[model samples]
Target: MTRTLVDPHSVPAELRPYLQELVHRTHSVCGPHLVSVIAVGSVALGDYRHGRSDTDVTVVVDGALPGRALPGLATALAHPALPCPAAGLELVVYDEDFAARPSGAAGYLLDLNSGPSLPGKVSLDPAQSSAFWYVIDRSVAHQAGRVLYGSPAREVIAEPARADVLAALRASVREHSTGAGHLADNRVLNGCRSVQFCRTGRWQAKRRAAQAVAASEERFRPLVNAALRSYERPSRTAAAALPTADVRAFLAWVAERVDETAV
Candidate 1:
């Protein structure tokens, strides 16, 4: 079954006009080559917080956009005249072939992150890399994505393999836990969600995932609560309130559990 488009009214008032403009501009730039533009992540999930959240979009094109199109799209998106309304906009461009066919590979034509602060920034050089995360993203888009243009998301995006999804989650947890400093709120909350998904094959938002972890595991309650607070009201003080050592210990424990389950 196809998912319904996100109710425009549900979008943040400040962000709605900008999002509409973005879709219009994207269509103008891509022309007929553009397959669809999908709104994903928090905005699509109805959990967006004006200043804290980001506007995530997936642009599916017919094929690799010509080299010249890149700069134009970047310039258009980052024009000082049209200011971004959130922390930033994270947009990933993928080819229809890639979306229709799930390859356990990593590569994207354009991965653009731009906003008023960082105008016209593009990360396309490393076109080839392990894109395990894209698999999970595709799954998200297929299930919950909001289509701004073109057909239903399921028509253009394929379901990711369960193993690939697990691999991506494992990689994310490892990356987050490798450092020694206090973990970011997203890192802590996402780590919990990843563990939960690995164990139960159910995906949930970060806060809900933290609640689930707290409900099931008494040992993780304190750290999870700290993360939840940080997620709710993101601030350096809230983040610093977390017990760094305990957070690391919890992450390590989660890593071990994920590893055990994988085995």
Candidate 2:
């Protein structure tokens, strides 16, 4: 049986109030520093898992942000009153590095359309193409997160439908499973299979993989393990490589823990 997990509210007493405060703090300090604020992830979707989720917020400055604001920003996040005590925060200062990327922000780029005046903006166009799609593809591929804060993330970008998710997955699979004798990266491969494909070519592949996932979890586990392990390796070239031994061993350990509570 799948183990029961605690509800998010039960796990974090101050989370809601903290987030509210964050909205205020951001608007204030960011007046000069930020032209826009975009909230992303499950939090924005309103389906955040208490202990499992971290806040994914994008603060877009007028120009590039100076180094001075980092501390103030950190304080706003780690303020003792909030839920979960700011375990971590991803502050993506969108500038040239972001602008040059193929798949901007992440793989599943949820653009925010918060409306005029507060016409919030954080562009994901920078990431519409490259390896970054792997991240975006996975988020939307899962259940739709609740809209905890901010407007609809889907409206800002040119998603054109669900084609973006399919495209990202296709790119991910090709990168991880390319070439003969190459060990296919399983974790990512599984993700590619998990998401629905909007395009005709990818739709067929998605269907085939979906059938395979349903038929055999055991067969898929190894691939998942391999990809998860190798996902963080330093990229030397474009080749699909296996993960380090430490990664493999760590995954094995996790498997043991999961099996321990098996129904």
Candidate 3:
């Protein structure tokens, strides 16, 4: 059996009202079909910065959710209506069976990306898979996701293969290198995260991973520091932009380390 989150205080003080509203509205819309609500990413990881990190939530519903529940849930949780307190809300809905068992591929009923600056994507099709990021996020959720409203994550979430997860991390580094993904904070910090995962097979906090890289990898310290400093800021201004060449080289270095250390 898996353990649920033991301490209510584990969830930070400042975000409680938003979380309360989240749970209330979610229960209102999802009703009995909703099985679990797990908080992944920064909130679960204990390094959330209100203005910087989004409310990352994964909802599990009983398998075979009715058609009506989809849009109802979307509207209920979409920003402005629910009023996300963080940078935004990264929310995904999965059925109980899908979330509770191990699988080789990625799937979801809905991926609602909403915020003031977000894409406002209400992804409903299981056919459209963003496996690179999705798989990695799911893997992290399995290991670190804290229970908000359901069984413990260890009982409800499946464990993905280490190799598959690392492959996605490598793909992410490559994607940024090619300019397909270009957020400076994500690119630089994700590079640190990728290398850290390859070494430990654990998705620790990005800032912590960057700090680890800085301490051990002398050659990359300055670049890693720049990434860390930029990541801590409230917003990404032009001054926060990391050197393109250094970013590329750091990602290249991360790729090589991933190849070497991946289990």
Which candidate leads the pack in TM-score?
A: 3
Of 1 and 3, the candidate ranking higher by lDDT: 3
* lDDT, residue 39, candidate 1: 83
lDDT of 2: 0.39
lDDT of 3 at 210: 86
- Writing each residue's lDDT as its tens digit, candidate 1 over 111-190 gives 77776433445777534544755666777787778787776688998777776777777776777776543346767887
Q: Which stretches of candidate 3 lie over 4 Å from their true place?
A: 1-7, 237-239
Candidate 1 residues lying further than 4 Å off, grouped into runs, are 1-7, 79-81, 116-121, 126-130, 179-183, 234-241
Give TM per candidate: 0.86, 0.41, 0.92
Q: Which one is best on lDDT?
A: 3
RMSD of each: 3.6, 13.6, 2.9
TM-score of 1: 0.86
Q: Which whole-number lDDT from 0 to 100 does residue 194 have in model 2?
A: 36
Question: What would you estimate as the lDDT of candidate 1?
Answer: 0.72
Over the stretch 1-263, how does candidate 2's per-residue lDDT look in tens digits?
A: 11111123522353555555665665555555444344445454443434333455554444456655554555554424233333334434333233223332353222322211122333345354354443453243123322223332232222323444444444554443333323334334334343323212232232244345434556445555545344333331222555545334433433332233231
Give the winner by TM-score: 2 or 3: 3
